[model samples]
Target: MAPGEKLDPLPDPFILQPPAFHPVVPYVTTIFGGLRAGKMVLLQGEVPLDARRFQVDFQCGCSQHPRPDIAFHFNPRFHTTKPHVICNTLRGGRWQAETRWPRLALQRGAGFLTLFLFGDEDVKVSVNGKHFLHFRYRLPLSRVDTLGISGDVSVKAVAFLNSNPFVEGGSEYPAGHPFLSESPWLEAPCSRALPRGLWPGQTITVRGLVLPEPKDFTLSLRDEAAHVPVTLRASFADRTLAWVSPWGRRQLILAPFLFYPQRFFEVLLLCQEGGLQLALNGQGVGATSLGQQALERLRELRISGSVRLYCVHC
Candidate 1:
């Protein structure tokens, strides 16, 4: 990238079975292939300014008269003076004891990313990119086949990932899984054309496993003139992440580099009005500012380095 060439933006890449975008409130859907260890459900949306509260429930079925059993109920109560979260289970139409968490990491009227990771004994919930709490399984997870969300909240996307992205050969996803079967792994040094170019509010997700004995890998965004506008490098040996440009390279040392060899990672790049926000495994990492014109020039995404890419959702 040229020193003053201006960093370009990354466009929205074509995706297979992209997550449900802008679903109606009080949404419900079957948990494809059912819940199992290593699977994950990701909800991305904004908490409305006037939001009172919201709940995410895992149910056995959508029955009404006999009310479907709730395997897990995760509710964030913002209406209360002291914001908190309540977790519980419902069996035989009766609610069980409630577990309360006194902290609320979500902000009103802001975008948020929440993840529910299914494990053997509990479900790990993370808000944005930070680990929040775990809800032990009262009802067997095997009995949970449907997901329901209701209350004062707006949902942008609801995605189900069949397997953990961090483990090598984790759980095997069923054939035709949208995340895997459709957008299969791509070889290293991969490059894809970004026809639409990135726009404000667009996001790009790169999921991959770092190779053992890794050196470094770079993700770059180039313009139509083939000039790199933005480039980020993760150096395993140096334990640093660098922003490269014609001017020079700026590096930040991470106590323990997140891009370690044999590690699984999901990187999210969110395009904003005048900058790009980056996150690793759901945690905010870094961001860079660029002019509006510069962001409009981004036309391609190039992923080259020491990593095996499982998928790229632009």
Candidate 2:
């Protein structure tokens, strides 16, 4: 082997989009790119030990002055001996007739994952990855772009994922071969839109090759207001992986640097209730915490620096 030889660059991984980790209770964030069929919103957290009830609302906006419209209001009541869930909508600040589901899918002091899958006519809900129920949309899904969660729960993460990428965004990929479709290799220093925004249980995978004379490269998840939720910086010279929080604080990891000059690498970022978990080449790296930033507002992915990108999937 040559003493000063460089390896070839590598390919990227599939991104599951950005996700919000360990968000505060009573959380509300704008849903960028709006709602559509084939998209799913995931919530992972725990019900408080001494909790009574909680509510998750899909609203038009986060306006308090006039009170924005609520397209879907999912309220779980533990006040009664037999817990139940109530689904309703609020339009013009008036409550509509509620539909009640007698079954309670969550319990106190336990972690849970709730998934909301959007469809053309209704939203199918599941708990712990199993189908629970379906609710017909009282209002158009497009009108609901804000997600609000409140009361009696400690949220871990929130993720917005696409189950059917071929049908999304009018992609030119043929529907007959969904599994064979891969995005074309994108250039570095590029930005991609996260149509629905981040939530819990979402994963974003990045694959690229570190340049022969690499310095550093960064991947950032930002929102419409320029608020960044998470950023990953890989420094070749320093041999470090820096996890930048939403507050601009850096938590540098110095144990193992996964990037090498002209080497292809796949980095996976998983959004959980606690934080974002990093994995390099299928090995666990570490995690970083997010501030009180609303992850759903993180609608853009920006990648820059010394890496040559192969592709990005979100």
Candidate 3:
């Protein structure tokens, strides 16, 4: 532990585990303990074909009389031809100024997953594994103890993820191939840790299903340095992989194609002792030089594509 650094505890890994899948609309639930900075909430749902607007709210209390104070009000309006996201706060049944983003991150009738990354200053909304927008904090974050959602949306499920690795669950460091149960995850296009940080003998895994209407997808690793090393991409056309780096190095890797409606693929990437190794399914596909300085500098794992990202083990 660093001197004077606070060891913030993470919520129990099982805290947000839903009892069962919810495929209904106008859903509401408590966020267990409350809302806190560094907690990410995942909402998987689909907008109805005739949907107009839907709202996701973070409430300080779950009272119904005279209405509870809302800490964060995230509403997506797609009524008319135009669509946008409105962010606001409500106190004493009154709303404050609103901020709007002119983008519809969710599509009608398409199952989508949105992540609300709660931070000290604001909450960043990412839809379908991409950065969307951020809304600043308008109320004391400590007061937010409940989550509520309503309007024209079909909710598949919801989960909460606390970023700290050492807090409640024993996800800190898993031996051998860490199963899906021992990792902190986001929808995708996200950065998560391996045990704690980059270390020797650590392995990286990404498992997802390629969508039928897919073109290609990419996964990259970054560092504080300007040079980001090892970006792995798979081409849907010929079942080939592109192993490249931000420094302009490319290695074409060919892997056998698998056909089916599922269209599943698992890519394992690792950077250790010798160099970078990438494998698809069980095939050794490509490699990249693992610079010595890049060891501890390797910060995150990112995947972007038309696939339902299952798990990313870093």
Candidate 4:
């Protein structure tokens, strides 16, 4: 050491060093340790046992002031193999856990990693390098002791750093849904070529011709008999559309410029018992109900003259 000399950034004290022996064995070696930052271990082997028997233990910081950062356990007998993250925070000297799974989890073979951070207002969970959850006020300062991970299967990689977590949009909506159409509006001379009949549990795809106005308009399904109208409005502002139920008159502003004109735009409306479910192409957008009045008695299922750029599908 010399005076007035700057010191190099010290290597991560938590870095996991090479193990002297095989850190993990078949079923007996359930816990593995010796990383400066944290530790990762796998459970569940070829042995015939209940999935719940698999457990993970996490010891944070140092042995003198060890903090139980996180732990995970699963059982296979009663549940199927699915990826998920469980979060917890210490409140009033008590630990509370919250389980969160991304919408993408509905798909098969999706794996996710849980990140715990300090000074973070929310827990950021990522799957396949895509951020999914932005949970607010989940982990507090006092509750975060040490960060660790454990699972039933082997982890590809395990590392931690001082960074903020965030949530990124998934493939729930096609890229074109928000980018292709801008300031989408319904064209005039709009007519429901399909006959008005009992559309119970049916989805009616509406195709209309867009005019040169370059303005956004709402496609509304009105049951004249009940004075209820369900509207779906699309806009270029966010490159997405929303459904607005007849919950009294509502208004939404669209972008000033038009993106597509004289082009055919399509939306699907699902027929339900009391209301209709609206969606863009095949993605679920929103829904609206028919209220006490029976929607079957509708005389006209045409677009109401009242048009807007905003509609929240019920």
Which one wins on lDDT? 1
Question: What tens digits encode model 4's per-residue C-alpha lDDT throughout 1-314?
Answer: 25985433323321222111122422222122222111122111232223232223233332323434432222112134643534344343355665444233212232333332222343334333344454455433333333332333333323323220111222121111111112344323244433354367555544333455544655655554545456666553343445565664544323121224443333456676777655432234456666434555554444432232211111
The residue pairs that clash in candidate 1, if any, are: 7-229, 11-198, 13-314, 129-282
Best by TM-score, which number?
1
TM-score for each predicted model, relative to the true structure: 0.53, 0.52, 0.52, 0.30
Kindly provide the TM-score of model 1 when superposed on the true structure, using C-alpha atoms.
0.53
Error of 2 at 298 (Å): 36
Q: Is candidate 1 or candidate 3 better by TM-score?
A: 1
Sort by lDDT, best first: what order?
1, 2, 3, 4
Off by over 4 Å in 2: 1-17, 165-314
Relative to the true structure, candidate 2 reaches a TM of: 0.52
Error at 71, model 2, angstroms: 0.6
Report model 4's TM-score to 2 decimal places: 0.30
TM-score (C-alpha, index-matched) for candidate 3? 0.52
Q: Where does candidate 3 clash, by residue pair? A: 194-314
Candidate 1 lDDT by residue in tens digits, 85-156: 999999999999999998897778888888888878888888866788988999988898899999988987
